[model samples]
Target: MADPIPETADTALVPTLLGDVIPRVESAYVLGLPSPQILDLVLERSRSTTVLVATDEEASQLKDELPDAVELVTAGIAAFAQDRRSQPRELVLALGGLDGLLPPADTMPWQQRLAHVTALAQAGGTVIVGLGNDAPLMALGHAERIDWARADDDPTRPTSAAALAQALAAAGQPVTTVHGLYGDPVNPGAAVIDALATGSRDGSLPAQVVEHVIDQAGTASIPAPDVVAVAARSGQLSNLATQWVAVSGGRGRSVYWTVDDAVVWADQDGPGLDWVIGGDADTAAALPQRVPDTITVERTLLRHIARADLPAFRAVARQLGDWVRSSADAAESSEIRLDEVRVAGATLARGISLRHAPVTDAAPVAEDAPDVEREPDPSARQVSASEARLAQAWRRFATRFAHSGRRSAWPAIFGEEDLVQLWLTMSGVAPGTVAPEADAPAVAVPAVVDEASRLDILQDRVAALTDTLAARDEQLLIREARIRTLRQQALGAARNRDRAVKLAQDLRRSRTYRLANQMRRASLVAQPKTLVRGVARKLDGKVRALRRTR
Candidate 1:
């Protein structure tokens, strides 16, 4: 670890060391036909040597029941990768199954292939994986066999080694012409070249080869991902790794490839967490250790920036006069309201707002982004008569992009509008807008109407109880009145028996007295409290009866 202290400041020139990088091509596959068919086609088209690595189990099977005209090498992928150091390869094209070069099948998860690549990815080697169609291979996780729909969804999404080889070139990787590193492109190649055509300063493709050569680089053509900012806020880019660099840029913006030089800078970092790399000429050698006080990248300070991290890019413009601190432009999207902040689905209004928004800077967050909720664009607002109509039916537009659950569906029905109030209410987003007028949707909330809510059942029970209580009271009162009348008539009649002169009058009067007496008795007996007490007394009187019934 030596600083660049000008080795020699001669009359006019000073010498400097240029970095080195190696080219690597990785192909993602779909597992089945893509492995057996498309892979070979690409190899043949690219004019590279294709070797098949096979394990004992697969070799036994393939040797007996070979398919078509598939030519394969029978070593395990690990063994072959190790042997590359001994025999070496200019371009190692490894195919599938018995065709793989690695041997000893007890290891290697097929997908990661971690064991072999570790040793084989040196300056002398360039690795290329051939996948015919890995759809079935990847699909094996969900089902016993392959799923056609899911497998074929995107035929070319997997790594294409041919494309990768081109990407490495575009990335300014270390190796030169296929022959320069592997020594001779294909036949009778030497393990190392003791010959001519020195490579780039970094020992990549020879200056002659990469000087202006821009062919076959696919990822190189795409637009580079920009540094999107969220002010003080941040999130993890789940789509990529922790140490991410813009994969495509310059002539091959779309093309993504890794250079050995990039890895060197990343590994040399002395725990420079979230520090950015590559800022002006100063960042070239900025290792992390020197800036123990602040989170920093080597000289550049660009390497430390997190994918989702957003510290005000040039908040104070910490520079000397004419110098600007950051080169990244701010991401222009509007911010989520401080009140609407949500974390793990708890309405974090008062309790967690302080956590999300530290007082230092006002930055937006990118983690757990759902589609954005729309607010009136502050620029457009004038009170009008439509206020009434709008209140009655304010239609806030919502598309699939407005929520987190459905990022994939954004392409279809984009920019569509639905009632903002209804959508917010349905999804339970904070600060839900309500219907404009008092009468609007005043019946019941949608959640109440849902059959699963059990409102209907509760309402039925309430109605049944009301009817039973009302009817029972009425019936008991009538019974008491009838019994009283009968009792009064009997009493009057009995008294009149002594005198036959006014038979009907005495009978009537006696009946009235009997009825009144009966009515009083009936009232006492019919009382629910008295009936319950009598039942309890009877039970007490006949304990044996209760035991027998039991």
Candidate 2:
């Protein structure tokens, strides 16, 4: 195990990126071992009082160390995020033992958890982490790294301070002057507090450090690949790419891909790549080839910059300028003639000025070379009849109007079909309407011919009428004969009816008929009397039987 720093307030306060960033820190993520000194300084300096500890061990330790007024919770950052009992408060988290806390391969989950912690800290919270040496630096996101080296002296602090200063300067936040942290017997745990106190003692320690680093970084010519790697490690790749796009005169648009074992960079959604560099070689060898040597420094240098990528931009820009000069000299020594150039398959040439004659008569064109005809894009192609009509109308309207602007305005005046018909009418052409036929013309004829034709027609009509009259007369005669038969049948039926009535009257007046009616009436009256007498006799018999029984 490594020896710990001696228990003394006298710690050599080294000027570092984190130290420079500490005073301006409304929030922070100090990635190193849990420092009681640092925690005490943060709690004293920061406005937030709530300290959330991820592990039970940290929580137990904090409960004993922190003041009773400061609330300490053992809940993970995610749990605090879900709790809505009150408004979110700025938090102080003690994250330690990263190597044992999370497995190395579990990057995605680790990133997600870290992002959750970041979200929790969004409300003015600060996270102090104890990062292992093998910790994936990229997964930490854009947080200031504070190295917790036990050794009283560390060189990396100056280097980091320089980088931070240069980055900030490149982003247009220049430092005029700064103070260096090189005092013996300085408090490393209370680094921020010491910085502020030191600055107060000599007008501003951060300012002095920023100026010193900026001066160092501005003059130094570091390798471009080293700068890129540093930015990537610092989680500023996206910012770097954005700056690159902006520098290339692209509207913050770029795509990354591999071509011929080299990274091909191009405009967003463009037809082809603009710059190619990077293959099996490392970043240093590949970076110089990103742009052609002919491109000017002004054209390739980024104008728009993000604060996070400021350090990276400064490092890369300074190095690229030096590389460009060195590479240009090398390229001059081994220049190839146009005739010696080998164009790849499907290579496109545009406005290329040929310094020499045709390169060996343009080697025989391949028979398989496709005669490509571009199909119009769906969005660009005219697909609708309405659009076609609108286009046609626009052309016609342009022909008529003095101002071209009237074409768009004319549509509001007339509906579609109406507009077309109006144009047709205005052109002195009939608008697709069928006119009624005019009355026939009156013409005179020769009397003799007219008379002969009329007489022939009249004769034919008379003959047809005569035939029709004869047929009608025949039908009338048949009807008359039927009517005569029907009248005779009616008369015969009436005679039979009169005879039948007379016979019936004679029968009613006859004596036999009268006697039969009187006899029927007498039988009906006697039957009822007989029924009553039988019923009385039966009742009297029943009465005599009942008296005998008694």
Candidate 3:
């Protein structure tokens, strides 16, 4: 076993993540090598006493961190269960699961080890077991192939969440609920109870929320969102989760998921389920006091897309457009996202309000100004704040929509930019009114690539490249025309200079020129001052010519 490590910020939040499932009790016993932070949370939440059972290595590090008031037992599962001093407790937390508590020397079966742990909990008491799924979708392409010939591997261990639940039931503690833990198994960022996970209908609001939770927990190796969508529709998402937190004789919240750094959980005690945020004051304050009901505009649209129902999609699109136009504040309308807008019967209202830092506009530059090299400013635009915000929101939605892989009313040939223009028009915003700057940075969507979406993305890329090439071609044509005009002007000036030189030569050669020269000499002779000035000018010109020769 590795040395016990100190609790991290994420691990510290594990207690909060599992807080609903872990019941408050008078006395609690935590078995195995759980995180020190979890132990601390248990200690703090327990009313009277808390006991920790860990190996010698883990205990060495934990002893310094834990107080003397808590009893620390150092023994294997076999020895600990055989001890007569061991008594039933109100809460038994085996968060490390059976593998962590089992010693290599001990030959106890997995089922028996589970039974021993449950026996420590009193009747009607709560037992929370954290078990890793045998196979998770996130581990699909990354994990190494297992060798069937390995003799040391435990054969009797529970292979799936269902098997583990059954094992717990057989151990005299029937599971009350099984929460699907997402993200890291040690400290899951989100959890959904079995009731919600199994009961939510595919393409419904609750199902979409669960799908989003899995998407957040997914890694780069797997296209979690797309896989989760398909799996949720097929009713297999519960089995594909990374870890399962099974609870016996205790009730927990229906759902819990993290947004940004804050945790949001759905309260089941209320007449209708309502979400409450728990985190830092600032984060909590920024989020809505209550989350919208399950049926959201985004979910309804997605359902329509899945069925290829163009009329239904158009109806919802029209409603969204109408809502955007009717909003008293255009700035507020810009912040409203399809997912955040809830749908109840025929009524629609904005639900969650995500706090985005206000974007300050820079001083707009004149269009006819001379070209100069400078850094591009995103906020330097002629568009109003409302138009800019609307454009930005529309662009974001377009990018996400293209990558979503759902069937849209538009043709397959339509790219991301085309969809943006279409959607903008549909939302009562003119396509040409708010022109996106050519140099504006593209909005980045989640890196979830699947075969279904690959074609759409490639098509969009090709269309974008085509448009870019066309613009560049037009620019090149304008530059060529300008260059041609300059060349003609230079030629005309050269011809004019040649004609003036010839005329001067012809005039100097004519008899009239000699007469004019003599007249000029006569005039100079008549005025002495003029003659002196003329002589001086001639001398200066001669001197300048001499210097040039030198």
Candidate 4:
């Protein structure tokens, strides 16, 4: 709410994530302190609204930001609930959840808070609650030491999605759908329903697609893709999600993913999943009309690697090569990355049709200017030409695979370059044609390793990279010294040249030199024949002198 953070591409994620589920109501009530952008979204969706914040400071801040039509309430949950006990709003949004809404000074029970929120919403009105998972998978990797002396302020707070959903249902507002939120809590990159996560199979398209979405939305510290892979295999992804959004009295889309700032959502109501993009109108318009294939070749390959299925991996690689050779043009082939290629039956399809054409802000063109066909920008063409060559793409994949901390089908001795060559050969590409750029020394990654060994591998890689950087730095220093010496020499030569020119100008400007030049000119004009004879005699004398010397 502090001057409303600048709207980014992902700014509309929360609103759009909840938009379909939120009923089109005339009035709404927002309890607790949600983001200003979210409030603005809520305001846009509803005609009239009321916002309640715990502190006077928050109320004062939001008062200037919210419109005049919106009624602002500043009080704790108990006070707000007592004041508005009789007035139940049509829609209630408590995205901040119970943590922020219940102040430490207030002794209100957790169940009572939930009851207050549900009571604030009229019967059949939507109540959306965004709750944090206290026992998320991240806790396993990054567990904080408990302070036994500290008081458990909110002991009854729901620890998991199920408990939160159960608590909400027990409060008379039965949850219709529970969405697992991933990435940033305030601005989640993905929102998937519990049903989809629970129903998806390990190698199915839905499972692959969900994993892909989770992969993109992973946290920095945890290897989310690997964690998700393990979790999905064990059928515990829903239970281990970072956060959950419990929706009561409304049904929402099954899956939501934020890609390039656009929101892609799909409902599991049809035979085939239909991904719909929702965001900037221009961006949505520019995207391919047809829905993208659910599963990506990268995801498929990753799954194969996870399961140590060498034959399947090789077959997919060959399929990808065939697709590149037969289906794609030269320009398109250069941009075909594994992640952007989709598995279409036995063949492969381009996952995103407009990878090269990024959505950009359209500047107004001059009306008077002629609509002439212009050549593509050479820089862009050069980039496209250099991007995603067969060897290069495979090399990138190999490097990722090496550092992925997942089990691989290849031998322990197989480094990134070895994997690259092997993959290229498997893909039916002539590895002999690959002129691989001189790369830093490869770190031999172990095929399988524990967390400690993985850390050791990472350290070894870092050490190798550091050595490479040091060598490059030494070369750079030598080049810099040579450049400095050349620059000094050039400057000295310029100064000498300036001095020589100055001296020449001084001689030319001297009175004696000027008088001599004028006298010579006058003599040549007055006695042209005499001057010519004298010049010939001088030349003859000079020739005799040169002949005598020789």
1-550, model 3: which lDDT tens digit per residue?
2212111224534566557666678888888766656776787778655554546787787778777788777887766777823578888888766766756566677777788888888889989887766555555565451222111356667656677788899889999888777665545656777556655554444455555655554553656556666666676767665667788977766666565656655555442455554454665565555654456676677778777676787677666666555644333443666656766455555555333353343435678877768786665556555555545655666667777765665555455766666666665666466654554433233355566677876786688689889999999999999999999999999999999999999999999999999998898889999999988999999999999998
Which model scores highest in TM-score? 3
Q: Write the per-residue lDDT of candidate 4 for residues 483-544, one digit (tens) a residue.
A: 99999999999999999999999999999899999998897879989889988999999999
| Model 2 lDDT at residue 426 | 38
Q: Which segments of model 2 are wrong by more than 4 Å?
A: 1-33, 84-86, 90-108, 123-550
Ranking by lDDT: 4, 3, 2, 1
> Candidate 2 — which pairs collide?
11-186, 32-130, 167-310, 167-311, 178-207, 178-208, 178-209, 179-208, 179-209
Q: Rank the candidates by TM-score, best first.
A: 3, 4, 1, 2
lDDT score, candidate 1: 0.29
Q: What's the distance in Å from true for residue 470, model 2? A: 99
Give the TM-scores of the predictions, in the order they appear: 0.23, 0.22, 0.66, 0.64
Report the C-alpha lDDT of model 1 over 1-550, residue by residue, as the tens digit.
Answer: 1211111111100001001111223321111112233343434433333344354565555444443444444565555555565543343333222123334335344333433432443344444332232221122334332334312433322222233335444433432322111111111011111112121111111211111111111111211111111100122111111111111111111111112112111111222222232211332232221111121111111221222121321211112001111111111112212111111111111101111122322223567767757687555545322222122221311221234132221122122232334323333322333323222343233443455446655665577679889899999999999999999998888777746667766776797878987897788787979878878988887997778898
Model 3, position 305: C-alpha lDDT score = 70
- Candidate 4: TM-score? 0.64
Pick the winner on lDDT between candidates 1 and 4.
4
Displacement of the residue 279 alpha carbon in candidate 3, Å: 6.3
- Alpha-carbon shift of residue 77 in model 1 (angstroms): 3.7
